[model samples]
Target: MTRRPIFNRRRFLGTAALGGAALASPAYLRRAYAQSGGEVNIWTYNNFVPEDFQKQFQDETGIKVNVRLVDDQGKQFNLLAAEQPNPTVDIMTVAGHRFLQFVDSDLLAPLDTDRLTNWGNINPTFSESDWATVRGNKWGAPILSGMEVLSYNTDYVSAEEAQTWDTLFSEQYSGQTAYIIQDMMSIVMLMMGYDGNMVEYLDDPDTAARIVEEAKQFLIEKKPLVRKYYDSGAEVQQMFVNQDIVLGHSWNGPAAALITDGFPLGMAIPQEGSYGFVYTFNIANNAPNMDNAYTFIDAVLASPEIGAAMTRASGFISTYKDASQHLNDLERKATSFPDEQLANLQFFRAEANELKYGLVDPAVEAIKAA
Candidate 1:
């Protein structure tokens, strides 16, 4: 098997496509079940687990894992919700922003911290977010985090010019800057915060709304400068690679790939900070293999090999505290855990009803039209 770089444009797909596929790495397929002698099923998206993660976990715990990849969280959540009486999946990973809706609907089971030996091993800062907790009970554990950063093509923009967000809207780069069309709230959050405290906007709906409006207006003002709006990380990477764009607001995975490939690319959190979207693992209320589920979670968290592999391949910072020791300098810099980002990490959370009722979609459409 050719070892692919951890994450690349070729692998980035839309959320809808990401959520429904069954992708098993060779290591996973060859491993035998150790303890339960039963199968454990996990449903998650791209980068949630390194390609080799399932294999490493099975080798350590003797648990056979069956992984199904889904592209869209909303679709996957609905599918799991429909399967509530008897879920086909034992554990599902959902984005942090959407976890409350799952909890309010009772689609997820409250995590039994007592059953998780590694529960204490997780840094409380990442695992203890109100967004990951429901009804004052912990329902999820952060597994991976991705942030929006300014990524630019060095072949085009000067190093100094690319260091700020202005590179994305500057006239010199007209029709050569790109941003994700779907990240309205994140874009707004970034514009509103100076160097962190992006989380504060989550507490003030009025402030968030005002920020959104300002950001929308900003985008509309720059519409002439945008080459094209993109919908997935892969798409942005493609545009950058093709030289259709000089700068963009993009995620770490794509930026890492470009840098590793020797593209004249640079990424920074910028002085104003960035927005983060985290994905977390949650148990289902109707989990058929609860013991296997807990074992699976613990096994993955316990495997330094798996954690290191994830960092190397996926560009996602593993949530387990112990995983840090296995990481190299680059890996350490990638996650928000210990140093540079510890003070700035922001999680997405809100009540289920609030999210369901929020008409942010229309607001985004209004921005595009305006």
Candidate 2:
């Protein structure tokens, strides 16, 4: 995780002082012991782990689960960075690409695959990915996967036209398209003939910068075609359903839910490719309860039962090998891609040079300014 100006020494000191006060408070001490010993604090995006699963895990293991939800992955990185020297949270749910930032900063502990009895049952694509392992040490366990694709209202845009990123710039859809602001850089990179996976070419600084600038220019040029830029999938879905927008960039999960609800929606796999990500569970380096943390992860991955439950709740596919058998036809159809489509999906992995060359944030700021 890159350290931003907002999380400086003064902010850390303030947070630490507040934490000290909380720990010293009589009311807090009265309940601290009960919440500390067998408890595992998790920092994750909202709804990734359903409340029912938390209850089930607590019942089966006798360990208390305290979840702290964040609005996005970037906040997860910021929080972890701020909680330095002594992190209060024990485990975190992070996106695959961002896992490397944690691992590189020594914020995560190497996971023991032996403790995870079901590790062998994880899909090879996830377990074998470079994102999950660094120098032969596994840092996290894969939980779920999803795609960022072009979602269009079938009433205004034909499925055929939606099959390419060019649809975003089409004259027919001018001022009628909404894009997820977070995806602007990747969308521009894909349109510029790059694979959209920055990790693949990070070692080549010249090439990386060239592509970043090209993507930035593309976004600047195409800004006039977009009606609005959204930060949430729900916002994009609402606009699509209301017929306020014909096409937009969206995640597979929410798009699937909207389609199931009878919205005139369809997800398209662009010819250039769609962005893919795997979400993982990582143990904090300063975890107060290591035993409970391992137990929690093991329970989550022990079988297809928990994986299926999570998929049903989040509308994302599980990395559990046998999870498909438990999914209904609609759930499977919404999440899984055909073999050919799967081949075209591009994963965002850890790029050691990302901080130095990444232009996504600047591009987003420029779009917002425009």
Candidate 3:
């Protein structure tokens, strides 16, 4: 069944531009056009919501969603920080680590659960003090959540054999595994066990550095086996599908993609434990269209039709508990919305500025040098 395209920002913008009267004074017309309870500006990373869901949202709410794409969380945060009281968009989707930073700077508004009717449907995993809570209030609600798992090619090895990080460094799978270019911390956490506790490594800078050295040493020793580290999930998936990789680190989304495509791939949380992050949707403090913004969010979470479409397209666990009943068996199993798995998973904590960036890059570079 082919899905029909519903009205969206581009289509709406094109129509508005074509309306000769509206284009006469671009800035004034723009402001005037946005003043209506018909437009909601959203800032987020690409592919968070499926195109079909965007259309569904527009169709259901009569609110046109204008999404501004940013490449990374840092860039998005920087942009939002610069536009404090008067911002461009009404909402921002930030990852777990970056959300804390935004909260600390007062760049975000207190999330109003009173307006969010689906607030009760939120998974208990997100209710933790360490995850999204700031001063006893939930600042953001998770849209997509996935744990970092060991992704392996089932064709190359049995799932039992590919169960541990130690297997990646084993001689058998040498030259067939890949790692993420930017996930130095997780790699280090898995390698040294952070002196027996992963969170401890993240907390103490000196201890983290020493652990990074240990992780680097492990990686350098296994360099011959690594095909190449990848920056994007698509790249990693391509490599795995082409049979160029036998083992690597990945999240549930990519693994699910491979499985859905009939590839011989599987993902595991590992015996050492697994960590994951969530992307939360926040209303931008200075958004021009507040009513439309609320309408859009409400539609996203409350409307089962839109939520189902979003889950199918984005491969993310729907935040709405009941909406997930619409997902197929495979999707339901892979989704993070299920409290059983999400509750058991370990979440990364927010800390000082240095803890965020300082310990990661240097560790990877040093390992590459050695």
The local lDDT score (0 to 100) that residue 303 gets in candidate 2 is: 68
Q: For residues 1-370, what per-residue lDDT tens digits would candidate 2 score against the true structure?
A: 2322221334433442332222121121111122223788998754567556676567556688999876567667778888886899888987877776777777888888888766887899898877777767988899988888888877667888977889887877888888766565776777777756676566676777778777777777888888887766557766766567879888786677565444567887788787788888889997888888987787677667667666755657889888878767766777766676677687776664355325666666776786
For model 2, how big is the CA root-mean-square deviation? 11.2
- Residue 282 error, candidate 2, Å: 0.9
The TM-score leader among the candidates is: 2
TM-score of each: 0.74, 0.82, 0.76
Give Cα distance to truth, residue 151, candidate 3, Å: 1.3
Q: Output the better candidate (1/3) by lDDT.
A: 1
TM-score of 2: 0.82
lDDT of 3 at 51: 61
**Top-down TM-score ranking:** 2, 3, 1
What lDDT score is found at residue 352 in candidate 1?
A: 28
Where in model 2 is the C-alpha error above 4 Å?
Answer: 1-37, 199-203, 352-357
lDDT of each: 0.64, 0.72, 0.63
When sorted by lDDT, best at the front, the candidate numbers are 2, 1, 3
Q: After superposition, how far is residue 181 of candidate 1 from its true place, in Å?
A: 2.7
Better of 2 and 3 by TM-score: 2
In model 2, pairs of residues that clash are none
Poorest 10 consecutive residues by lDDT, candidate 2: 23-32
